[model samples]
Target: MNHKPLRARRAPEVARAHILAAAETLLAQGGVDAVQMRAVARLAGITDAGVAHHFVDRHGLLTALIAYGGDKLRAMIDATVTDWLESEPDIGVLLAKLAGLYRQGYSGLAVALHAAGWRETGSPVLEKVVEALHAARFTSGVSAPDILHTRLVVAAFHHALATDPLFGTEFRRSAGISGSRDDGAALQLAWWISVTKRALGYDE
Candidate 1:
């Protein structure tokens, strides 16, 4: 006797979540190019038509993935800011967390999306970080210049970490730093952490 395999039914949201999770895994493994629809469908345990039913096409899926990443980043920033407001702030730890997210291939995906003409109107994630830093530095008065400076600092750090996966090691080597790729990355992260801390007036 032959047995048929069972297919568990999922809610639409659940199915979309599974598809996005599968896409993220592919992105982490081999950047944006690896997140093909059929591969996503196979990894998601769904049919190609099922994947298409949700995403419509690769571009739609990728757009949703970018939005998904933004949501994740926003949540991370919220938690980090809560910790910062409630206790001693550790800028290094915060910066390291930001770097870790970029290292997970989201950075490359972001760049690719931008080159493909996908532009974000604004970043709530950046705004939250800037607000937290401003509140930490000033208790009473509002300084536009200070806020602007904080914004610039955060933007610079974001750009650096986003590009680090692509150019960090070579950039470090050009500056005469020598060792394995991991070593260069570590050194670069440490330097950025320090600079960010100092710029934010968190360093002693």
Candidate 2:
């Protein structure tokens, strides 16, 4: 919805970005199954062949989208960290914002890509994205061990986002947690954030 209609010619990089954006919208709306090349082209205001030129096939487009989403995630994290530094927001509040952002912006798309990465046995772009994520998480004053622990906590948060929707009830039933799945997940996330802040000696 935010892109221009394709002209006779456009910058290749710009065109690819628009196509990927369309793909992401469709993916979020209808899951991976909904992201056909023709659908993406129609949404991006390009020809199916035009999209195919940029991405070889469905899997290729999905992979490229994974990388594109990684870049966006990094940008969002950078912005969040900047705001956190300036406002010195409470850790609970900050973590909640981050959780909401991840859940809404990245979780569904990431779930599909993560599955693809596993099926493929590895993905270079995915690995780099993950490494960049870990590097971005380092707090200035936190020790290595503390940073590692914080990463673990953050990983748990991400894992919950990826799995909770599908497995939440089963997980809670097995664990004997007495609450709605959403409520239980919220509590768990808050606890992890608290532990992460404590480990990092974050004053909030």
lDDT, candidate 2, at 184: 83
Weakest 10 consecutive residues, lDDT, candidate 1? 136-145
Per-residue lDDT tens digits of candidate 2, residues 1-204? 699887577799988999999998987777778889999999998899999999988889988887776667656765665675567545555666667765574666666656546232334323332343344345445445434555565666557656765566687788888887678878777776776566456655
- Cα lDDT, all candidates: 0.78, 0.68
Candidate 1 residues 1-204, lDDT tens each? 998998878999999999998987887677778889999999988899999999999999998887775566567667766766676565676678778877766677667655545555566566777887777566433344367888888998988988888888888889888898877887888888889877877644
TM-score of candidate 2 versus the correct structure, residues matched by position: 0.67
In model 2, what is the error at residue 1, expressed in angstroms? 33
Candidate 1 collision pairs: none
Q: lDDT (0-100) at residue 121 of candidate 2?
A: 32
| CA shift of 43, model 2, Å | 2.5
lDDT of 1 at 177: 83
